[model samples]
Structure formats: structure tokens, C-alpha cells
Target chain A: MTILVKIFGDLRKKIEGYNISDALPLNLQIESNGIDTIADILNKFSIEKEETYHLFVNGTYSGYNKKVKDGDRVGLFPKNMSLLYKWYFERNEDE
Target chain B: MAKRILRVDMTKLEANFENFPADFAALGGRALTSTIVAKEVDPLCHPLGASNKLVFAPGLVTGTKAPTSGRISVGGKSPLTGGIKEANAGTTFAQKLGRMRIAAIVVEGKHEEDDYYLLKVTNDGTEFIKANKWSNKGLYDVYKELYKEFGDKVSISGVGIAAEIRGAASGICFNDPEGLPSRYAGRGGLGAVMASKGLKFIVVDETGAPGVEILNEEAFNMGVKKLTNALTSHDVTKPGGALNSYGTCVLVNIINEAGGLPQRNFSSGQDDRSEKVSGEVKAEEIKKRGGVRPHFCSPGCVIQCSEVWTKPGGKDPVGVLEFESVWALGPNCSIYDLDVIGELNRTCNDLGLDTIEAGDLLGVAMEGGLLEFGDGKGALKMLNEIKNKTPTGRILANGTAFTAQAFGVTRVPVVKGQGLPAYDPRAIKGIGVTYATTPQGADHTAGYAIATEIMGVGGTADPKDTNKSDLSRNLQLATAAIDAAGYCLFIAFAILDIPEGLEGVVDTLNGVLGASLTVNDVAGYGQQIIDTERAFNKAAGFTEKDDRLPEFFLKEPLPPHNEVFNVSDEELDKVWGT
Candidate 1:
């Protein structure tokens, strides 16, 4: 199974060894593990929780705990690229 | 120097200075404009007729050291909406008016002559110059010539070919810091009201002018410190933040990803090609072309989201390609290339047309079989027709609804005769409520429900929540207060989460007015401004039925989400408790 991952803004520079020339979405081949969530994908890529602000799963705003399966699309935006700080902070407080 | 109002009577060709009314001591910006319009102008008067009055006002904290507070409000009966309109812009022109101690400039009576005139206001007095030589020219060239003639110390506000023809899509153009004719009070066709008065431009020279007076200096300082801290510290507004790095166009990718970015005249939401015109892409292009990014529309703005979009290798700057401008002109018309969008934006600036209205009208023109979608060159030609005052140009310049009716198209995206902004209401239901119920027609800034509906601010989080009447009401009230205070609406993102920031705003107001106004009074102040405008709109024959989105938005299912704007009419009417 493969999950398509897209990184936006300054997050592109943060990922180690990621080719900037390859501007298309990064495909991460994942074994058939039903437990794999967005957090696990971030962990696989070594992206810290603080490094990401907005997360979208399949074009819908989502949380780190949302499960990602094959053929799913996930997009990540960095903290500096944060568009809506209130929602990010408020949702964090609730968590 | 005591604050005063400049009353310019076009019929008599006279300019008079009157002492600022004691009753209006606390009013500025949108508050002052709406109040004066409601009190003086007959609501039923023709918007572009002799009876209409065009008002220009600076905000309460405008000329002061308040960060990001340099905003001006232009108010009058809107030729587009046929309702009371107050359109705001951030520019040094506003700051100049504020420093000059000119609270408001009311332009009344229409000139009987066919010639145009320019009103020149210095610290000494005001003079009228016959400006027929500058009539019918594009603003970009006229602005440079005016600056050369009047010198660098002056700020200008002028109309262009669109206003010369009294186009309903015309907007009042102002100068940026570099004296570029880019900043604008760019909605509701207030420029037509100015043109109908035969007033081409109003130039303000603030040389030797006395600045705004702060009654309570200590409170003002403290408030400024807190608000500045909030703006500089907030993740979304601070240095290196989203706005600072990519400008307002940063939302191109964000909104597109959320499945709310309208494409091809609201026919679809969220196209993959939208990334081609994303803020990140634009920033990269601006950097490569040596264009200016993270630029400010006015001096002293902390959130410098404005930029200069230049052609390849950085020639012929076309000012900022704002998110709404890019969306309306690019993706909404199925034209995704930034270069094409830049030229369209430049033409809009040159001709003094509202980018949103022009883009929406172009989309309608496309649907009406005037041209094919994605024909960027064709769109440019239509804009030129407006410049030439061709018969087809007249219909196009009247705005989206009128253009749609002319073409026999029924899928019109307008409310109160004004075109919708960038957001697609079908996906974001709360903003749909705002587009439906705002007295200013389909203005997104009238009530930016996206902050709460999408971003989870102001206690509402669900985007699809149909019961958003209360949310829209609260946001519209807060927005009115912010507009009156002269702070840019972007500041709301910081102040909403930062408690001290909100307090700081009230403190600054109290410092300026020498009257104690708690945060509790904020809503009431906003309510008063809105109530005044509502009364004017009600008197102007706008019934509850006016507060509605087009039928297409209700029935058509937008792609990606495939959701229609299902917020019931009852829910919409509940926005104002009608």
C-alpha cells in the first residue's frame, strides 16, 4: 500500500534528503497495517509534532490520529506557514 | 489643530471647512461614514445621481502609532447594491487624512458640466483644479504625473476610465507608499458616485499638518505596546509568518485544499491546477523575478501582506495579486497562469475597476457565450472595451448580475446586486450566511465567518453547521467595530486569541476619545454602526428577501464536497433577528 504525502511552505526545506526538484507528492509505501495513522506517517518521515501546524487528510482538515490507508492523500503545513492560529491553538488546548 | 470636516459642494464648485461635530467626536472610519450617510443622504436617492454624496473618512486610531491601523473608509449609496456602502482600504492616503486632522471629507451635489475637476487639500485650505486634461486616462500613468506635479508629499485618490463611464464596478483608487495607484476602496461602485459628482481626484498634502491628538497618552502607549506585541507574536501575523512570507495569497493553497476555492464561476470547488497559482508558487516567482514580497500597502503595517507583482525579470510592477483577485481573475475564470492573472490585475488597476467584480463579470461573460473559459486574452480585451466605453464594455462594467442578465444567464452569484468574493458558499456554509445576510451584499470582509467556521475561532468550529446565524451576527458586529477602529481585519486573527490584544484595542480608543470604553462596549458600538446602515438599507427598499444567496448556490452541488448551500432562509433571516 502507498500513501501520497504533500508538504507545503517551509516544510519542504526541513525534510532531510527530500529532492526539491521532485515537486510532486511523495509516495510512502506502507505495509498493510490498519493501525497506521497520520502521526505514524510523520514519525516515519521524522517530522516533529511542533513542526506541523495544519494537517489535511483527503482534502479535509484532520488531526494526527486520523488513520491513513492506501490511496489516501495527506498534506502538511509547517508552523511558520500557519494560516489560522486560533483553531490550531484552541484545538490543542482541548486535546 | 482641531479636527474638522471638509464639505465639497460640486454644484457650487466650493469647498468649505466645518468644525467636527461634538456628537461625532468618537466616530471615525466606517462608523462615521455610515452614520453621516444615514443621517444626511436620502436613502431612496439615486446612487449615481445629484443627490448622492461620497464620503471619505479616516479611522479613530489611523494617524497614530497603532500598528496596522492605517485604513480609510469610503461611504455612499452603492450603485451596485443600491444600498448604503462603506468600502475600506489601507493606504498612506488615509494616514495623511488622519494626520491632517480631517475627520471626514463629504462630497455632495453633482457638477452640471461635462468636465472633471480635482480637489486639492493642503494644510492651508482646499482648491479645485479643472482636471479635464486627465479625464479618461488610466490611473497608473495619471498617478505618476500627479505625484510629479504635486510633489512627493501628497497622497492621491482618483477614478479612471471605469468611473468616467460611471461603471457600477468602478472603485476609488488610492496610492501605495511608492505612490502606485494600487490601493483601493474597491467595492460597491463608490467610484461611480465620485465620478457622477464630476470629481476626478482628491489630493491631500499633509505637509506641516498636525497629527492625531491622544487625550490619554499613557493609556495609548500601553495599548500600543500590547497590540504591537500581539501582532508581532501571533503565529499567523508575526515576522516570517504566513502573511509576512507569502502575502494574503497564502490562502490560495489552503482554501483550495479545504475544497472551498471556487473555480470556473462557482461551477466547481478545489481544482488540482490551483496549486499553479498558489501563494508559495507566487512567492517563489516573485523572488526569482526580483519583485517585492512581504510589502505593505501603507506605512507601519506589521502584517505586510501586500506585494509588487512584476513581469518576468521584474519589469512593470502590477501591485499586489491578492488572494481574492487571483481567485476571481484566475481560477474562477479557469485561467490559472500567474502571468495572465498579473496582466488582468494590472488592467483592473489601470482602468480603476474592482478586481473581484471584473473577474466575476468575466466569468459571467464566459458563461453567456461571449468568450470561452480560460481565455485570459479575451478577458483582457473585454477590460479594454470598458476603457474604450464600447457598448459591450458598458454592460460588462455594470458588474456580475447585470452582465449575467444581459447574456440571459441564470446562474448568477450575487446578493443585493453585488458579486461574491473568493470563497465558495456551498462548502463553507457559515460564509454562505455572511454572503447572504451582510448589508454590504456578498462582501466576505463584512463578516469573515471563515475564521470561525473553518479556523475554529469565536467558539464555532463546524463548517457545515446550518445553525450559523448567531455566528455570522457576532462576527459581523465584531467586524464593524474593527472597521470603525481603523485596524486592518487581519488583526482579528491575533486579537481573538490574545486577550490583552482586545483590551489594548479598547485602551487605544479610550485614549483617543478621552472616554472610558470597556471591551463590553465594542459590540454595542459595532451594533450602532450596523443598525444605522441597516436602517438606511431598509429605507432604500431592501426587504428581508434581499438577504439571500442566489438560487444557484442553493440548488447546485459543488464538486469535491458536492454540497449545496443548504442554510435555510429562516436561518439566514435569523442572522439579524428578523
Candidate 2:
């Protein structure tokens, strides 16, 4: 399954050899034979579990445990954005 | 030690220092300004006439070690909106005033003659200097001349050509750390009020001035320590936070993604060129262009969400490019060219205009077919018209609502005569309640429900939820208190998530005033400020009708989310419940 991913702010530097273009969301086809959460995809990208980042799937803030399907637009932001935006990121809370 | 107040009677051309009134002792910043304006200035008095007064005050902890707490409040009856107004700016001028133990500077009674004057304040005394030489000049030039006369250490606050002409869109400009007149108490045409008094510059020299007297030294230290920890530890306020790294422009992408970024004069919520103008792109460009990133507007600011943007070759240096400035000039006008936005922002500063109002007016003008949408060069040309005070410029200089009325454009996005900011209220429904109900006339910072609805500062509320009147009111109250305290509103981000940080803010106030106030008391203080402002607005002939989003918002559906401002007027009235 393929999903588009974007990273911003400190997360860009955290990524190894991060290209500037990576800041804008680009498609990533991750092998997902089984259903997986955003956390799983982040882990596959070598993102540390303890890292303070906000995840948004399909333009809405999503929990790490939220499922990530193919073609979902996932955005990763540092913990700074959560407070900057007043902790409003978890858009899928109702879901 | 008693605080001092400087009362400058422009009518008499005399300045006097007096003891800060015991009745107004507890107040500072917005609370002080609003309270004074509410009590002193007649609501029905013409804002540009002799009856209106301009009051400048620093926050309680402005001169202290409170991180990001240096903000100055400028309050007066608004010429643009015909309502009470308090516009704030984060500049070293406030800190210098606080250090001098000056509670407020009150400018009253218009000068009989039209000759411009400068109100110069120092530790020695205050004087009115004939400043006609700098009349009708850009603030940047005025700042340079003032800096040369007063020295680099002195703080300068002045108006520009727009204010000299008493343009309704004019704002009082203050010098930043770099002595650039880029920081502004930019709202409600307060600059015009200042100019009406025949005052052009307020140069503050704090040398040999006594610093603020702390009531409780121990509490103050503890409060500073707690706040420092919260600010440093928080991801947003910390050194490597989004603001420090990318500056405020970071929100451009997020808001665009949320489908709330106002584009093309509120005709759309989303723009295809959103990524091009995002903070990420700006930051990247700044880095590539050898511009200064992570710039601080005032001294002792830890967050430093300000930045100095320059042209690609670094030939032309644009003063701090803020998120709102970028959004207003870039996306709302359908112009994504950063250079053009930068130039327009610089022009707004030079002309002593509020970029938000100026950009909104341009957008409305575009809607009126006066200019083509997405024409960056054309936008620049129209701005030049404003600088030259052309007929078209005069109309635009009056601000968004006025321009709309003149052009017979119905899609004007404004509340109470003030233009709506970057976020389209139709999509960001929580903020819509705030825009509709705030006494400040469609100001985002009045309640800032975007924190909860989008950023989740206090608590998460669905962006589409119209049942956020209570949340908006609470945030508005808290913000009032924060504004009064002179703490940068950004501190709310840290204090909201960190309970101790909130306590630290309260403790700072307690230490400064030597009073024991609980967290609940702060809320009460904020409520009192709101009540005072509301009373002033009411006395000024404002009613339930004034607290409303324009009709277009309710009837017209915005793009992406395809949502209208579904918040009911009854709910908006309930924002200030009986």
C-alpha cells in the first residue's frame, strides 16, 4: 500500500540526509500486507517512538494508533506545532 | 515605590508626571488602557477629534525577567470602527517604559495647530519637540532620524504618512530591537488618533531610570524559574521549536491543509500555491538567501518567531515577516510571490498602515474589479497608490469595510468594520464565534479559538463545531488577562499545557504587585477587562447587531470543507451571557 508523507520543522533535520523536497508531502509506497497504524509506518521510516511529533492523516490530525491506508496523506510535525496550534491536531478524535 | 504616569496635554503643549492613581494601581497593559479609555474618553466623541485620547501602557511583568512578556498596549476610540480599541505590540519600547516605572503615557486634547510634534521622554523629563521636519516621511526614515537624535539605546514610537493624513487604516509604529519601525500596535486606526493629537514620535530614553519594584523577590524568582522551564522545555517555545526554526509562517501549510486558509479575497479556502508560500518554503528561502531566521522582535524574547526576510540576492532586507502578514498579503490577495508580499509588507510598515487591513482592502478592491486577482505587480502598484495617496489609495486607506461599501462589493469578509484575518470563519467555526462576539471587532487574538479548534491549546474542539461560544469566551477572558499582564500571547501555548507555567505567570504578577491572587482571580481579572471593554463598546452605541460576522459568511459556502458559518446569532449573543 502507498501513502503520501510530509515532515516539517525539526523533524526534517531528524531524518537522515533529508532532502528539502521531503518537507512537502510525497508519496511513499510502504509494503503493507496487513492493516497498520500510522505508528507502524513511522517506525518503518526509522522514526523513534519517543519522538515528540504530531501526525496528521489526510489533512486531519490523527493518533499514532489510527490506521493508515493506501493513498492517505500523512503529515508529521514536531511537538512545537501542537502547542503553537493549541493542541488541536488530533482531528480524528471523534473517529 | 509608586508607579508614575506621564500625561501629555497636546492642546497645551505641556507634559507633566504624576503618581499613578491608586484606583488604577492593579491594572497594566490592556486592562489599564481599556479601563482608562472606558472611563475617560466619551464613546460618542469623534475618534479623530479633541475628545479622544491615546493611552500607552506596558504589561505588569514587562520589565521583569518574564520570558516573552514585553508587550505594549495602545488604546483609543477607533476612527475606523467607531468603537473602543486596544492594539498591542511586542517591542522593547514597553520594556523601557516599565523599567522607568512608568505605568502609562496619556496623550489628550488635540493641538490647536496642525504642526507635528514629538513627545520625547527620558529619565530626566518629558518634552515636546517640533518634529515638522520629518512630517509625511516613512516610519523607517523617521526612525533613523529619531535614532540619530536620541541614540541607539532610546526606544522610538511614531506614525507615518498615513497617520499624518489621518488615514483610517493607519497604525502606530514602534521600533523593534534593530531600531526598525516594523513593530506596530496595528489595529483600529489608533495611529490616526495619535496624529490627530499632532504627535508624531514618542522617543523613550530609560537611562538612569529606576527599574520595576518587585513586591516579593522570592516569589518573583520562583515564578521566573518556573516560566523559564516551561518555555525552554515546551516544544513550541523551546529553542528548536517550530516558531524558533521556521517562524510563524509554519501555520501557512497547516491551515491550508485544514482548508481554512482564506484565499482570493475569501472566495476560496484552499489555494494550489499554498505550499509555495508555506512557512517551510519561507524558512528555506531565508536560509538560501542569507537572511536572518529565528529573529526576535523585542529583547528577552525566547520564542523568536520573527524573521528578517531578504530578496534572493540579499540586496533588499525586509523587516520581520510574520505569519499574518504573509497570509494577508500573499494568499488572501491570491499573490503567492514572497518577494512581492515582502515588498508590500515593507510598504505597509513605511506608510504606517495595518498590513491586515491593507491586504483585506486590496482583496476587496480586487473583488470590486479595481485590480486583477493574483496580480502581484498590480498589487504593488495599488499599494504605491496608497503611498502616493491617490484617489484609489484614499479609498483603500480607509480599510476593508469602507472599500467594500464604496465599490458595492458584497463578499466583504469583516466583523464590526474590521476585516477578518487569515482564517476563513466559515471553515474554522470555533473562531467564527470569536470573530462574531469579541469586543475587539473581528480580531483573532481576542479569543483565538484557533488554539483549541486547530492547535488544541486548552482542549480539542471540532473545527466545524458551532457550539464553542463558551470556549471562545473563556479563551477571550484568559487572553484579556494575559494581554493585561504584558505576557506575549504565545505564552498561552505553554501555560495551557503546563499547569505550573500558568501558576508561574500568576506568581510573576503576585511578586510584582505584592498581592495574593489565585488562578481563579486571574480569570476574574480577565473577565473584568472584557466587561470594561464591553461597557465601553455598549456606551459607544454598539449592540447585539455589532457582534456579528458579515452576511456573506452565513450565506456563502467556503471551499474545500464547503461549510458556511453555521454558528447562530443567538449563540454569539450568549458569548457574553447574562
Candidate 3:
């Protein structure tokens, strides 16, 4: 089973080919196989291991260490976008 | 060599070319403009009065090999804010003026007549051409006539229908590369002042073959190479080249996801239309229409952010579309159509106004029930009234803050009486600090902490934290330096987050000026510039109390994201003082 790893912003370019490339709607397709964690998935894409690249397990922001399930649609994004955020309410005792 | 200053007393109709003082040699753009405003123009004088002086300045590196230094600063007492305002624009014309060795063009006093005229300049000298007939012509047609009469390479700045009516909302339009009257010195009603000077078009035809000569070619070329290389190799500057490819509209989705996207005139922070309004959409549309061409605004521009755009399947593009314009007309008005957004953009360029301010003003009108939310046609109707100078259009022409006040709308996003940019200050707490504290009200580019949050320009920070004070401080300081150089702020996207990038830029500046300046010198110069602007504001009747986000942003908890701007006023007040 393969999962669709969607990247946004700079992350999309860092992991270039894993996207649907077309002039009409610039998209990318990155193959995911044996990528258990978001970290592993990113490693496969040759993305640097940094907290800047936050993961979204289908519209919900997730940790990099979170387990990636087969067929799970992962939306990768930057951590801080604007000063406004719902992620603050996520109860990050460590942060 | 830099150009000599041309001072024009609108009252006396007298003018002379004077050299810039040695002390003012290091200054450019905001620094130069702000200093002139603070020193010469009375801060307490009425913004539209003869006491207020308009300073047009190109940056320190403008005539040199430094990239993207074609930015021109128009500074004066703002009629809308009643405080000092500096609106920056990018164009080849600014460099042409710089090459002409004009450090600054000061327009002071007012003409006796209500009739408008034109100000034309060439490499030899400047001229005030009489043209009361061109007063009410639409900007595009005016630009076409100017290009036809002068030449294609002529850089022209003129007002449109809005300015002739003395709309406090008008701006000066500049011709982009495609010869469209797209780019503008858009903010704080400077165009109306130009019109008040009995002048309309200010054209610089630098066609006489002698380009600006470098005082030290070796140094200038060295600096240009280092900065250009730094820009090309960086991540954001290369593939995710936001400005070159998508322009500023790239922020639509990212801000939406972060929950800072201002929808329908800041009613909410998130726009569901994010997917549609995102930079990806713009890029694709440009590709489909074959309008995806990019060009630098001036000579030696490394980060080519400014571009001429046309309608898909249409030859004439509305204007140079940016993120601010997209938000101002699109989500701000509940209209998500990019074509309509482009039309509104063209309309603003042709009419000579700022897109963000116009959108905010229209949003105020929408709240007043003059038009429904997302009513594209209705918004056009109001803009048309402004073009034609109808009674109602006069109110909308001034700016969003004014419109909000006139209609008793409570949610007007402004600081120091000027309209806010696309970012909702309340949600973006760091930027809120910027919005409140910057001399220019609610200007996103003033500090632009988003460079870190979105693209990690300098470095990534917790955008959600109200304690991102340090980041805000650094960004504000750095941005001031960047603005002074007259380089597009987008250049930071590549330079920051890269090592030796600062060193490279420093190398170029040293080369251009033949002065051995360091990175610390840049920071110090930036601080001095900020200090000057702050002092100007202080003397101009601003208090520490004026450094504040709108009252509602602090109190109101927005939906979709139940967060308020939690940054304390004390923290904001300490921004520059610290």
C-alpha cells in the first residue's frame, strides 16, 4: 500500500519529484514505501531533519515522529505560518 | 555618481538642482526620505498643506551594480494618517533618476490653480510641462500617450481619474516593463499631492545612451556578483522563487493554514478560498495564459519579483499583481475569482491607488451595505464612482480606515489611521507588533516576520508565540536596512537562512560605494534609519500611545481559530526603545 505524501511551500520543492508535475496545476507525486514514520518518509524524500517541516495527518498537524499508516494522506507543511494558530491549543507541554 | 536633488516650490513655481550633503550620502529610500521629511517638513503641519514636502529618492545602491535597487520612495505628511508616510515602489525609472545624479526630488508648496500639469525629465534636466488636458484621462491611456510621445524606455509616473478629483486615496502610477501602467508608489495619497502641485505625469526618458557611471567599477561589480550569487543559490530564491514565479499571492494558502488569512475585510483570518487564491493557482493561470514572464524592476536586480502580467487569453493584464492586492480584493471582499482580482488590480493601477487600502475601503463599504460581500460587479461600481468622482466614491477613495470611520464600521484594521495590509494583526501576533509599532501603519513589509514563519527566510520561529519579540526585533531592523538599500524585500528570501549571504551583500555595498562597510555597519545603519523615522514620528505629534494594534484586535477572539492578539502593549512599546 502506498500513501500520498503532499508537500506544501518550500517542502514541496525540497522533495521535488514526489509531486504531480503539470503546467495547468503544478502538482507532485512522491512514492512512499516502507516509510513508517513521517521522519522516515521525509528522509526518503531527502529532506533535512528539522522541526520546520511539520506534518499533517490529513488536515491535522502531527509530530514528525508520528507513525505513518499505509494509505494515510500526509500533508507536509511549515510549522509557523502566521501569528494566528490552532496548534497552540494542542497542549504541547514540551514546547 | 548620484543625481543632484531637484527642489520644486509648488507655491513659487521655482526649481533648482542641488547636490546632496556629505552627511546624507549614506542614506537612501526610507532613510533619505524620512530624514528630509523630519528635517524640512514640519511634522505638525497639515499633510496636504504647503508645509509638507514630498521627497522622491532612489536608494544608496540604486545607480550601482546592486540588484533590485530601482525602488523609489515618495515620502510626505500623509493626508489619511496625518503623520509621515513613505510608500516604496520598484521601477527601472528610479535608477534612471539616480543615474541622472538626482539624490532626491522635493516637491513643496501648492500651485495657485486647480488645473493639473506634467513633470517630464531627461538625462539633461527636468521640466514641468503644462498639460491640464491630460488630467482626467485613464492611467493606461495616459501611459500609452506618454510612451508614444516620449519613447518605450521612458519611465512615466502619473495620476488618473481619482487624483484629479483630489481624492485622498490616489497614488502615482509607474509603467512596468510590458508598458502597462501597473506598478505604483501606492500608499498615503501621494498622487493627489502631485496633482495639487499642478503636475500630473513625471516621466524620465533616460535614452541618451550614457548609463549611470560607477565611481568605483571594481568595487561595484564585485558587490553585484556576490549579492546576485547569494540570491541565485538560496532555497527560496531558487526553486520556491516566490516573487519571480508566483509573486506575493503565494502567502494565501500558508496564511490560511496558519489561520492568519484575512477573509472578507478581516472578518476572519482564514479564507476557504485559499486553495484557489494560492500562488499555485496564479502560476498555473499564468502558464495557461502564457503570461508567466518575470522581469526585474531595475538594472542589476537579483531577485526579479516584479513582473508584467496580462489576462489569460487577453493581451492587457490588469497590472503587476501581488499578495497584498490578491487579499485586498479577493478574500477581503469575499470574492475569490483571480480574473476579477486582476481586474480590480488593473483598476487600482489605472486609477492610481493602493490595492490593500482600496480593498479595505471597499470592505468598509460592504459592511455599510453599499454592496454585498463577494459582489465583484458591485465593487467595480464603487471603484467606477471613484474613477468618475461621484459623491460616494470620494469617501471610498481616501482609504479603508477613512471609509470605516465614515460608515461607523467598528472592525476597521488600521494603525495610526492608515489601513492595515493583508495580514490580520490580531492573529499574527509578531506582525501585530510590527503593525502597531512601525512608523508606516500596519505595513507587513515593515518587519515582515512572515519571512521566517512561512519561508524560514532568516530562521524559523514559533509564529504562535507572542514572545517572538526577539525575532520581530531582528526582522524589523534587518528589513529597515533592506528597504534603505531599495532592493525588493523578497531578496531576503534567498539571502537569509544562508551563510555568507550577509557578507556577500556587504561586499557588494562596499564595492559600489568604495567604502569598507561590514555586516554590523548594515545593522547599525538600519537602526539609525529607524531612529530617525521614530524621532520624526515623535516630533510629528505621535506618542508611545500611538504604537498600538487596533483596539478590536486585542479584545475580539476570532472564530475558526479562537485566538486574540495576546501580545502586551508594553512588549510592543519596547520594540524600538529597547
Best by DockQ: 1
lDDT of 1 by residue, B1-578 (tens): 79999999999999999999999998999999999999889999999988999999999999999999999999999999999999999999899999989999999999998989999999879999999988888888999999999999899999999988889999999998888889989999998899999999999999899899899998898899889998899888898888998888888877787778899988998987888898888988899899998899988899898999999989999889999999999999999899999999999999989999999999999999999999999999999999999999999999999999999999898999999998888877777888888889999888741244322234464433435787787788878888998999998877876878887888999888888997777777877998999999999999999999999998889988788988788988987888
Model 3 vs. true fold: TM? 0.88
Model 1 residue B490 distance off true place after TM-score fit, in angstroms: 0.7
Candidate 3 runs further than 4 Å off: A1-63, A66-95, B1-3, B208-213, B449-466
Error of model 1, residue B195, in angstroms: 0.4
User: How do the residues B84-119 of candidate 2 rate in per-residue lDDT, one tens digit apiece?
Assistant: 899999999999999999999999999989799988
Q: Write the per-residue lDDT of candidate 3 for residues B46-157, one digit (tens) a residue.
A: 7766777888888777765676667888888787777777888888777877777777889888888776667777666667777776767678887888788888878887
List the global CA lDDT of all models. 0.87, 0.82, 0.71
The Cα RMSD of model 3 versus the native structure comes to 4.6
- Clash count of each predicted structure: 0, 9, 23
